[model samples]
Target: MTDTAVIELVEHAPAIGRPLPDAVGRALAASRIVDAAPDPYTAGQWVLRAGSKVGAVTLNVPDCAPVTVRIVPKVPIARLFFLLGYSLDSRGWRDEQVEVAEHRDLLPALAQAAERQIDRALRQGLLQGYRDAEETSLVVRGRIREAEQIRRHFGATLPVEIAYDEFTTDIPENRILRATVERLLRLPGVARDVRRRLLHQRARLADITPLVPGQALPEWHPTRLNSRYHQALHLARVVLTDSSPEHAAGALRIDGFLFNMNKLFEDFVTTALCEAYRGTDHSCRLQDPHHLDEARTIRMKPDFVLYGPDRCPHAVVDAKYKKEKPDGYPDADLYQMLAYCTALGLPEGHLVYAKGNAPHTAHQVRHAGTIIHQHALDLDQAPDGLLGEIRSLAHVIAADPPV
Candidate 1:
């Protein structure tokens, strides 16, 4: 698709009166970057509505101009990065340290920050770690797999199966960094300078093993030996986790980088709340699983479940990233929180939204003796202000006694 043929749409806003080529429409539908439907008000026109996902994606079909659709998130690009960085590594990421000053868009800013972090991580040279390997070898190095040796060789002594630990730079940490660099190189909107730096990073990782496409990523543990890689790996994990690279849409080929704001909000809220409880008697569990019914048939997971020193749940919270409606925050959210409170046997529950139509409110369910509080966080505020809100909420949660 030509660079000039770009179509921009805001998150949760429908692009109306703009007729899309049938192929492009199909491509968008397949890419899942947005919801595409025929506009009822305008004949022969299409309506493309973006949901929680926000990023730039290019949808292509044969014999048509490729249409690059950019979905801008409701939150500012810098603030979105803060949410992402903090969620990925709460203690390491600082809003002022991210440095998205040069790039106003999400993709560029992310690419830049990722490249910088990766470069810093490699300044001291690639980290080396021990990796377990099992292979057929001419000679045993660590230990011989006698069972495998006999099964494959039928008692032949020429070759043997062996298991060993090899110390190498091609460990999970390097592989994750390499995969993230490769992912950034393939997508659009990366700055030319950033692309050069990413290429250099790739070269530094050239000897490392590339991650397999359909296989689970190799796991890495945090230790003092690889402490320098913590920040870079956190950013790399964020890039690798929240993106869709190449996927087919019938004849069209789609490539895009997207992030789900819903998940980002949830992760940030839950993680920051946990941080708030640090050094305190209370502990916070993220995505705490519990059954809603005594039969243990219906499972429920609350975003944040605060437990007291007695090891009992004191409060539960759910994070919601949504568009403000005309009347108020949806009642369905209140219902869900109520269910969590009832299931957790807590006196009250909380619902936090990115923004809300009305001020903070609470609902008391009659006869149930359960209260559900709805709180709206102003994400548009500075990071300090936003985090202050979380601290305030944490205090409120601690102040309430469990019934």
Candidate 2:
């Protein structure tokens, strides 16, 4: 096995085992982006298989030089960005804004894009907005908490507990920007220039309270006042979602940014479907929860459930993004969708998948009398065609007869 600092693999690459240094193999085995297993046919060889995650990560092995593992996605990089942006905000996202024609790697491209947007957001200076605050004040303010004063102060009049809204730059929007900048700085592969610019943004937002790592982010609403910050905030959320500094394999440290294609595809599909139903009488819920059994213990959540004007489930659909095998579509997915249809008391269910070897197909369960339809959405086409496919699916779903 040759010693190298980098290893490149494609998502769902063929299962051809390759030789690797023991330390590298161990480190790869510990990462979540791929599965590393010992090769049964070849001695001292290991197979690294990429799953739904795509991006680069640096694995630190004990006594060995750091190795960076880059998993390339099946879809084109530009399309991947489209999926991400559309998922963030379907109506506001403009793929032209995210320029990635020069970049091939996910981390550097993401870092560059994030830095540019953050810079644009801070160009006019930090945005100021009203934030609700609560504290004990010596002088009376907006409103006094009478119950708190009686319980904590025992009716004392010296200090009063008050709640008020104050206009300030230290709001959720700025804090999110700062936290995202900090996160980008920690990850490897960021261009030096981009890193420097992110630092500047952080300094501009230094006064804002930094979000605590691993805690829920502070809430912010969309309005005319904070319109300029919308684009930047959306990118910040994409960077922070499913990213953490705590990923570790015992003593070996793993630090990098990754996006789960499974989640991205699901979000884009469900959100697009919801958008298609915007003005229609039907309503859609993403991840609608239900129970499969009489006791209500076997809980299941379908990717999407369309509700009609009667406020009852009209259709059920699930999104799947996996490499299709030559044999046919996976039976397990059909089974799961069947379960969803049964639980929702619907006569039919739908399963959407990324384009694969198998085209759209349907299955009829014998005796169970349930029909499950499988649809494929080709992601390689232009955004208009991609969304057009979703619109067609929406029409079919809405027109389906209910049980």
| Candidate 1, pairs of clashing residues | none
Q: State the weakest 10-residue window (summed lDDT) of model 2.
A: 322-331
C-alpha RMSD of candidate 2: 3.3
Q: Candidates' lDDT values, in order? A: 0.83, 0.86
Candidate with best TM-score: 1
Task: TM-score each candidate.
Answer: 0.92, 0.89
Clashing pairs in 2: none
Q: Write the per-residue lDDT of candidate 1 for residues 256-321, one digit (tens) a residue.
A: 688888888899999999999999999888889999988999999999999999999999999888
Error of 1 at 223 (Å): 1.3
| Candidate 2 C-alpha error for residue 25, in Å | 2.3
Tell me model 1's lDDT, rounded to 2 decimals: 0.83
Mind giving the per-residue lDDT tens digits that candidate 2 earns over 210-238? 88877888888999988888988999988
